[model samples]
Target: MKNTIAERIQDFLKQFPPFSMLSKEELLKVAGQIRVLYLEKGAYVFEQDEKCHDEFYIVREGAVGLYRNSENSQNLVDICDAGDLFGLRIMIIKKNYRMAALASQESIVYAIPSSVFKPFIDENKEVNTFLLETFATHARNYYTETEKGKRIDNTISIDTAKDLSTLRTISYRKKPLTCTADAIVKDIAMEMNARKADAIIVVDEQKFPIGILTDSDLRAKVATGLFSATAVVTEVMTAPVKTYAKKITVAEAQIALIKNNISHLCITKDGTRNSKTVGVFSNHDLLVSFGNNPSILIKEIKRVKKIQRLRYIRKQVERLLTTYLEQDIPTMHILNLISEINDALVIRTIELSLEEMPSQPTVAFNFLVLGSQGRREQLLMTDQDNAIVFEDVEEAMYDETQTYFLELARIVTKNLHAIGFEYCPAEMMASNPRWCMSLSKWEEQFRTWMTTPSEESTLLSSIFFDFQSVYGDADMSNQLSDVVFDGVNKSKRFLGLLGVSALQKPSPLGFFKQFLVEQNGEHKDTFDIKTRAMMVLIDGARILALYHNLKGINNTLLRYEKLASLEPNNKELFESCAKAFRVLLKFRARQGILHKDSGRFIQLNTLSKNDKLKLKRCFKPIRDIQEVLRIRFQLKTFM
Candidate 1:
């Protein structure tokens, strides 16, 4: 009864439902009465039509397969892995087991008493909904129509007989009316009316779309006397119209609309404004083409009320990103759009965690996204790096306040992992006690790092300096940034140390002009594009920008642009760096799409002759930029 194995089982069960919804005492009670069942590969826990056991099971280790018995064969319904719950349908409905539960591999499962968990199913709405949904998905896949009606009367699952992929690709109207920028507003309105359209594209003399004249533009700019009816279309049109290339998927088109808060996307022969206009994609068209819209995704995220539903949405976003890349959408635009959705997921996870807390937070707090995510450049699913900054509290309440935030951060980060963002391998997440801190303590920590520049301090500074507020009080994050920049402004030595740190990777090219590759570990024999190439540019940009007290600029390309403006003498060098960085990013994005990994590793054998040459071309600017960093910071002495 007092075995460590029982305590381990309790710990595992305490995270999942209906066990999670139970009080600690009630959970331990069930835990005490639990039996540990170990089964080898291909062993069945219970066969179809067998009487229900007195308890349901949670997979503690390995895998379990839930299979349905047909007239002639058994069909696999679902695979249950670690942290997944199974065998609960019988306990919930009080019926004979309709499906056989078998261990797909050597497995350990916790058998929790049905009597102890039953009360929680009635009490926790979220737990109940989760169980019902899981049962519905399994039943829809396995059960016959007759069994569905009788076995799960209250369950709701869409069992439509249509290919979901086909539903997502249905085409819509694209031939929209167009007018020259110099055309009169009244003529544009007439063109819209004549074509039976709600909007008219305003193009330059080259036939490239430059602006749009929609019904709202007409009412606000023309009908309101803000502009004359005889005014040129450019006077009333929305300039720099959102544009997309031909062959965009319904998901990309919808995401564009939501991100820009626009109803239409100007389709061009090429994606930029320099190309001829081809067609138009409207929000209405996207809705008709794909039944699901951005609002539906947001609604789903909110309605999730559980981590599993959020995981499903995250998978859908991955599918969306894959489609976007296949269609050759701009990487910057894709990064911005996907990062927004990722931020929203983190925000929602925080909201859900708050609900799970026993009470509201004792004080206001801000959630900070660090490293690549903070810079809004995370394209692939990477480890999450984050920290929490809470408002200062009295000395008496400091320890308890910190404890509360740590607990909240744990829940938030765990849920983030469930949604596809891997846990930070270095433990840089908010869940780490060293990171979850009060504002004053964080300020002191930053000051310590800035004033004393050790190898570890410089490394931590490089990561923490890029912090962005993903959720909570923006003022807290702004204050922390102010503290960081103020410290850097005073410590010239520290800035030089940062510059030296940024130069550690050297050039990404080898002596024979071959691409430099990783030396060891899991990624041995691979080229670490992120550490060797991308981070060199990113770290250099951050250090130089901070030295100049630059603000509101994070992207490496944009930082170079700002630096060019500040240092006219080095304008060409900076501009070249900007262009090379963009080219390298595009290359990495394309490779990531092809390999479905982080794009950090490159297979030299897979590269075409042209790609290898193009990659080599970018290395020149990388070497030149490192030289410039060395001179400007006088890093020769440190090296």
Candidate 2:
């Protein structure tokens, strides 16, 4: 037989998982021996309680449903789609199959003998780690009996910045078991023991830290007769406790601890010894905060004097995101926390760009983040779509002012690229001359798009209309928004144009509930989840929210919630649309985290039957919403 089959197997295998970690020769070897099995729809590959097979299967076509058989019922546990591997839990655990695999449709599966895959697993560290993590996450879900996949280990990376603004900064003992200057050494020791503290802070009546007495102080001073047991605490205590600000970073705390040769650093409001004591940072506290913390990273970004340092910090944020997703933290919290860090990075980029300018900005300016960043839902590093709005300048100065902001935008966008946000392919970013403009120019631009409402103008409006102030003057953004709403109010044609744009893509599923997977390009046969499912919800929400004159809220989910309140008759549909948006977003984030890309493409065969059913459920509202848009806006007349 030709090696075409084996090569095809390798091509599919190289795209996923532990198999991707395998070398070409090794992968080919496994592929060559792969036993191709064909099964009719509803045919069983293995049953629960049956002894394990020597090989595990990867779907070549169609789908397989994995069902867990309990005493009374068989529950669908997972669905394996094309390119998804299954029947391996038995191989991993050396036990009988606890779940039964049945062909969900007429399917082709390539069974690679476990013996062939085992050698690679043993030799490749990444392969081993992937298997361990995947198995652990799956096992955690099973044991918890919850859909939440795995509890992420928080200490692994630094980006775990949950909404720090919301989290109460942990309070610590500020006075710190202090004793007066006249207190006896024995009294200090007793006080330390009473408080169960390793050390005690010595202070004057004003509650300011003066010195510290530790277990070592008693051991070296009183125990060795360097001081009598009856001596005053001042005679034994080490003078001047190290101090820091309440906003001290974990790294700064580490450096302070190392530099001072001290265990605790007194925390004050102003970060100096002169301020009133707010709290204390012990070595233990330093260790605790050193783990994944978004606040620490944000603090680091503010201190970074160079673009390269900011770039390094951004990478740490990405690593943190990977860990966060792996842990399955609440998706909303993850989104909020990451958005803050991203905002901080953008702000830092702007600050750095200003420092490099020939002179300060000619006028007040505001940087506007459009699209996903505006929505505060960007998880992965996507394109940077932004604009600039400088203060209204005299007609004579307008061109120069626009040039100045455009130059600034170029620098900021460049730094953003250095830190991993891909440059927008369509040149939609602030660096683009078309997007960078003075306040009046931007207002005019928005007015034209809103009034004319051509295909290009509608597309531009779809993206730019969601602009949120990222940095600089807020009034400029306010004026722009006012102009947009005014123009939108005057033009039914514009709203209709937007409605047609939202309905550009058809529903993601066919009548039989099969995914309309891509038919061409590098991602052929893989479903483009973003264009097919996610964009539908995002575009629909934007159109409806703008049509309703909803302002401030750009998030698709929140927009839909607002829409629900505005139109009570359609509340259920709007609510379902919101829920569907969240579900699709979570799915895309999980899939993106899994594959390390945009999570746009999904292998339909890889989804479990339940997941497919859940995804299909989202389309009902999508179809209904499109119909509403068509009827209300009379979009068909425009078509």
Candidate 3:
């Protein structure tokens, strides 16, 4: 007869421990021979002098007290929580029980037959390591002077940035209150007053954070009579609010607050501005994260007057970035703050360059940042990809205007290199005469690329299309965006070609469910995360955003998020892509910081079981989105 109780026992065991390492067939066999025992509070499961039992026990519910006895006195050693295992020492050593087990509360435990479990212990490395760590932490710790593992303690903290690798996790105010962007200031202020909260994040219909309103806004903008109290939140709230994903520690949270100069930060589901709000942090949370002095760095950046000063400052920023990564700050948050610092460096370099010039420019021009700078997802110093888009000039004066702008671009790019940004190998910077052009010329170039997409055109446009105006006339950049999107809107054939470009990288996994790694050359057997993983999401987001006509939103995570809101039926899939993009970004940044290089090619053998699982989980979303793109654009027919 089939044993339903044992099948249920196997199900519970599979989610936990060394049992999880066993095959379903093997686990069921072990489960079939196990015995279930129920005990009320203070009931003894085993005594100190009991003979060895063939089975070891796993607590399914409540808690068990493991006590050490000496001279007619019992010392409570440890409280074993749910999923904790005990009575394994006797089975391994073939000795009598050394300690007594009693129910601290009513509990259910499964006694596993050791005869059926020994083979699995010898076979699985992860299982063996886990069991050894468990014993060393639980059994051996109770015998140590400090007795660290005798209780579940999470109050550890490391203060200095130098020692940040061991910092503790900081808690946040979870499930924070939020209002939509459409809400009026007066109503939201009343809600804030009622809740006694200092700030309220303004979200969109999907609860995606768009901006934030605070008591400061009420005082500075409303109380001063600058804006009416009945004005909408969008009219006053600070837009592009700083956001973070759920897993942050004391060190990461502090850096975020000081770096952004914000008293409060919006914690969201994906740590991008496009995700639903989940929690919030303020100056108080910074204190909780063990506040470090960050004013020095900010003062330097703001007061910087030379290229060498910024070069020195860039090193400090790298150190700060290392600490944040080591402390496990969410990648999205790090990207947001670090990118701000990078942009400031560019803007400052541009200012200093203009000061060195003989006079102000003859016409308004914008420094168009491209490549990773354009995406705003850059984590490390990479090649500069930029161009110059100046106001249109009379054809007769074109030669003069081009010469003036080229000279200006030369100084700006040179200063940027001194400030640590590497020069583009392909001369893609504004310093290249080809990249510096009139606004109308840039518009014509974009129209040409979209209407006639080829391999070379696709490669060049992929970097150029994500152009962001770092400094100068912001309005000029807006005009360029409208022109590019307008051209894309006119051609279904172009959209299909862009869709085909997105599918250029196939699945990141191969047969045997292993990462599809570089087969030969310098990075043989190593994973190409940038080309195979990050690019997939980045390309997908760009094409989708263009299709939906979303402009000025360059970050891939925000792109997927905006896509999710626009298509509710595909929201889950889109959100999954966003989450996966974040995980990959974080993973790459961490690897980069660890190995002191571009974290592009990753060695697979270095990863643990858990790390592999996290990386593998991201591939599913990548596969799903590519299929959606293929079917939607009918790209297979073109292929």
| Winning model by lDDT | 3
Q: What are the clashing pairs of model 2?
A: 79-608, 81-605, 81-606, 82-605, 152-327, 158-292, 245-271
Error of 1 at 8 (Å): 21
Candidate 1 Cα errors over 4 Å, as ranges: 1-299
What's the residue-level lDDT of 261 in candidate 2?
A: 59
- In terms of TM-score, the best-performing candidate is 2
lDDT of candidate 2 over 1-639, digit per residue (tens): 779989988998876667777889988998998999999999999988899899888888888888887779987666666666777664455667778999878899989898888887788887765554344223211321121333323433335433221112433456566667899988778877787777777776676777778777788789998899999888888877777777654444544564465667777668656666667766554444444568867876777777755765665666577657656676667777788889999999899999998999857999999998898889888888999888888999888888888888889999899777899999998888898888888888888787666789888888888888979998889988889888878877888888888888855887777788888889999988788887778888888887888878888878888898899999999999888887887788777755556788888778899988888888888888888899999988988
Report the lDDT tens digits of candidate 3 across residue range 1-639: 988988988898886656776789888998988888898989988988798788888999887888788888887655565566888764345657778999888888888778777777788876665565344223322121123333312212222222222133446788787998789999998999899788998888898898988788888999999999999999999988999887765445655654565678888888888778999987654442332223334444666766766775665566567656655766666777678778888888898999988978989999989978898998888789999999999999998999999999999999999777889999999999989999999888888888877887878878898989989898888998998889888987777787787787856898888889898998999999998888888888888888899988999988987899999999999999999998998889778755556789999998999999999999888888888899989999878
Q: Which candidate do you rate higher for TM-score, 2 or 3?
A: 2
Please write out the lDDT profile of model 1 over residues 284-368, one tens digit for every residue: 5553344322333554566667785677666556545654554466666666666776777888999998988899996899999
Model 3 misplaced regions, further than 4 Å: 1-296
- Predicted structure 3: lDDT: 0.78
Write down the TM-score of every candidate. 0.59, 0.61, 0.55
